[model samples]
Target: MPRRTRVLLVLFSIVTVLCAWAGLMGLGRLTNSGFLPDDAPVRDDNRRLSAHYRAGGADLVLLVRADTDVDSAAVAAQGRAVGERVARSPGVVTAVSYWSAHDPALRSRDHRAALITVDLVENEGRATRAAQDLVPGLTGRQGPVTVSATGPAWASVEGMQQSRRDLLAGELIAVPLSTLVLLFVFRSLLAALIPLLTALVSVTGTLACLYALTFVMEVSVYAANVACALGFGLAVDYGLFVVTRFREERAAGAGPDEAVTRSTRTAGRTVAVSAGIVALSLCCLFTVPLGFIRSVAVAGVLVALLSAAATVCLVPALLSAAGALLDRWDVFARLRRARATGSAGAEEGAGWRRIGRAVCRRPVLWALAATAVLLAMLLPFGHAAFAPSDARVLPAAGEAHRTQEQLRRDFAIVPDRTVTIGLPRGTDRAALDTYARAVAALPGAAEVRTADGVYRGSTHHPAPAGTAPVAAAAPAGPVLTATAASGRESAEARRFVREIRGLPAPGGSALVSGEPVRVVDTTAVLSRALPPACLLAAAVTMLVLGSFTRSVLIPLKAVAMAVLSLGACVGGMVLIFQDGHLRGLLGGFTVTGTLDGAVALFVLVVAYALSVDYELFLLSRIREEYLTTGDNTAAVIKGVQRTGRLVTAAALLVVSAMVALAASGVTLLKVIGVGLAIGVVVDATLVRGILVPALMAWAGRWNWWLPGRLRRRAATGDRHALSTDEGAEHAH
Candidate 1:
């Protein structure tokens, strides 16, 4: 065997063993965690209590309305029959109907409407079956009842089920399409298979890790879906980088082993640097407050890291082991070899001489134009507001949303804020009376009913402190209850929270516990975390590129391009989503002014890494030309021309995948997909093709200039610039 082949095979075997062991270990850890499907609503305390009160109460909610009246003999009988059937469900905990409560209004004022609450089995798979059973049975034209399923149970069971299907649809579409693109790009099944295998193994391993994460942290149901998308997408992208370079080297008359070595050393470095940047960017999510957002960042980082490692380590080994058999399935081998038979281009210095001559001709004009354009694209983002979505997070077409809309329209309620202020189960009557007045008098106070030892308002419903619904009789003293509005001033809600925090303990017993408060707390945490994460990612990118190019200016250029790419992507998404251009196509979801907290962070990270891919591609070629010719101009032109086609192809494939995601009914998915896709296009064509080259052409030798200290350090050990006469000729 050739020495290079021997080296690659040995390295490949070692990494293969390591990856297998790691995958097995990760799986072992995953197996220990409980299997709660992604959409399970076991997190809410009320839902948990409801579940305990009636098993599966958190998974199945039935809303039955009568247009005429719920109390009529016909309506009552219908309600009873429905309740009885629901009660007999295999996993039902309890059934509640208007007749069951004897509340006239609960039956609806016109006597036409009533609600049926059916709690199902707690297990997610069982809950799903029972919930689905309730929906079809309750719908009918003749019956007075118009039944709709709503609440955490329905979301957890039904919404989750649909989400899984949508995700599967995205994956099924992405995998095959990506494979075709890979086959075209590599011209061989063997080369394509290496990356595909790496993607599959990495994805499976990431999922197993995600399953294991449930033990150390809370993982969102959506996190798994995102992992598959990001992990596989990144895998394909990284695989493309490595595989393309390996083939390029081989076609240049390098042996299989030599090609693997060259590909690993050159393209592998770029993949590593880019992956690190991507992971670091994703880790920025740790600064956000929501567990869902944090989980996405964590999962994405894990997957990106693994994908990068696989591309650099696993792929090389596979290439080494397969040798020429790797290209055996390539239909274009003869054509490709024939193309390579042509004479090489000008030497390094000669090409650079021509490029430098052209650039020095009009440096000022080129620099001014590039800066002005990028600044204009970045301007729109200043108007961008980070708005959290409420409705779109749930399934687009669902009962919860319909019910929520109805509730909002009829009652003037905002479903965004659901909170409860907790008081001890038993408290002093005097303190309760005082607190009730204080809550009722608040500026945003809507209607506060102080019956049943609880204050109930239209706004604050969680653990309501007012009467037990208007139907239930009032409770005696030592009971806690209340509800209030979101507050008139908008800031009033936040101000009220502050007031509540400052209020005298009222016998040292009152505490506030609710989702809103949790959100506020989480936001604080996120605000502190985001900046550091961004800086860290930027630092890493700068360091890696600086090391690779041994050029201070090029690293700075890469960072600038990355930032511009992010701004362009986010700005375009804001236009598409916040502007509501595709609302109808995306299941009629209203684009909130801003993206979800988690989605924005993730899209930003992904965009940054994508920009880095182009940066590295261009820089690798440019630096190679520079070292050989000692002329920056020639390097810029030759480098752009050489990598331009590959970059364009990669961008197309990536953007296509992103556009596919944008077609999803899920609003967040659509926004993220469109944003990322648009960003890749902008980076690949506009920034990489035009802006980067123009800037380099203007900078001349300064493009490769490093400070004295850094230059000496790079000279000692980290020399990435390889400028040989043959290499220059081939590049040209």
Candidate 2:
């Protein structure tokens, strides 16, 4: 058996290394595009138009600033040279500039800076790579002008780089801190290492699995941050539960082998069931048609499965092999020796039982107070604004973000965000001309440049001397270069897109595509998906809990409590991240006044699963006590006493693993981390500690009521080990 275990360990090591290799390769393949569904009008139209026109809405933008007039002979010649250089670069589809086009609209309001826009290849990943390669060369001082870049491709590159840095920094802080906490909680140095090792295995495996998933479907880089963190946290959490329960069995006088068996039967089952519910919750994210949401969903499911596998298969064997040595390197020697001698058992749960009694004494008041506090946290969510991520989500001073800030402050027209009204090719010039003229008349419309000419409202102006055709249709169909317009998040840009879409085409026409339009479509799809995704997750979670407990009412109560807990967390996120409160304390991230819709959805899924995980932990102990004592109130008190510390310890481990995300430079990851940390605290204290026992006490025997068949099976010790026979199984 020892030889077999050795061989198995060797095999696991090989697989883990291979998974790491795959994950590395997968990271190279990660792309920031494909977020919008293929069928989304904006996505489809963007692709279709890119094929027809010299446009993909400018993947890279260069702001060429001259010491004086940008159009001066020297600056114009230098700027045009820069544009030509960009145009000749590999992977560049088209490049246009104020110097080359001599178009008035391309000039900044101050006339000291001019815009140089490059349209890269239609493939989003390649486009971003090309921009990344080009930005270093084009930015900084060149001949007669200083240049800086900001656009979609640059934003993508910046996001990937910052995310990598944040992930590393976060882990550095999270791992060591978590190790110390686990050392104390587990009562031994060697024992504490189990969860960390298991978490490493699960995280690497999940990353590798996610990379493989990339081949079959679109996976977002955004997904990796939350997925790996969640995988690590889950593995660590499971480790704490399984090992703690093993110690309990030993304290109860069971032999090491028997203790492993009993703990696995109890804690192992709970972890497995917890994993199933979490996986199922993540799977529900597929109902959202957006690519990012689906990517997170798939990655989360993979993490849950991998984390559960690592904890279950590896933890038990280590415990068995160590036997008497499991507590050898006791970090807390007195506590370890006391637990081993069963002396700690006397005082282990007295405090938690007292807490349970206090909460039960005023069940209604406690429940009401907890609910009200949760509701207060959720208050900020009432004003929650959802937006698509942009350079704003990056660090405040990143080149791409800084350049974007400059553009926002100085440029009258953000050409990269131009609303392109796709007019079918081969339309008559007269109809197209009319359409262009009408579009040029819209608010913030400075000039509608076309193959034929430029239009400012009803007036027609001849095309600039050297400017190539500016129409989204080479024929120029009302390409609203939103001038003096606010940012894409602003009412002006949204109104412009909305009004443009509302306009009738004079010729053959199809779609209105731009950043604002994409944001509108994304938020719309997410809004529609949120209700169904949450409902599906809730319904399925209840079913799983129902099966685990054999009590319908228990599952219902669990669902209510979990949602209430999560709602409060979401509110906290809105208050801090969106409302921009506590910015300095949270890594000094810039508040964008709105949460990324995709990130919010991901957070919701993660926090809910965690809430339910603790729910299952507490319920298992409560149900176990009730079955043994046959007194609901006593069971509630004892259950909280026995499991409260375990639940709290598990919550701490999960939080430690997640709080590393707060170390990330990226606000999105910080939001996920801090939100989850807050979530676990709420679940551990308010929901599980107070509301749970209080509600159970108020429900009395109804908490154990399981209708007809389930009650009988539960009595007979069928599946979950709730009867005396099942209890005897623990001592075997």
**Local distance difference test scores for all models:** 0.62, 0.80
Q: Estimate the lDDT of model 1.
A: 0.62
User: Per-residue error at 613 for model 1, in Å?
Assistant: 3.5
TM per candidate comes to: 0.75, 0.93
**Alpha carbon lDDT at 294, candidate 2:** 78
> Number of clashes in every candidate structure?
36, 2
Q: Name the top TM-score candidate.
A: 2
lDDT of 2 by residue, 250-326 (tens): 99888888888788888998999999999999889888877767777787898888888888888887787778888
Residue 218 in candidate 1, Cα distance off native in Å: 4.4
Error of 1 at 238 (Å): 2.2
| lDDT of candidate 1 over 387-491, digit per residue (tens) | 344434455566666654553443332323333344444456566567766765566555333333334442333223421332121121232222336621135
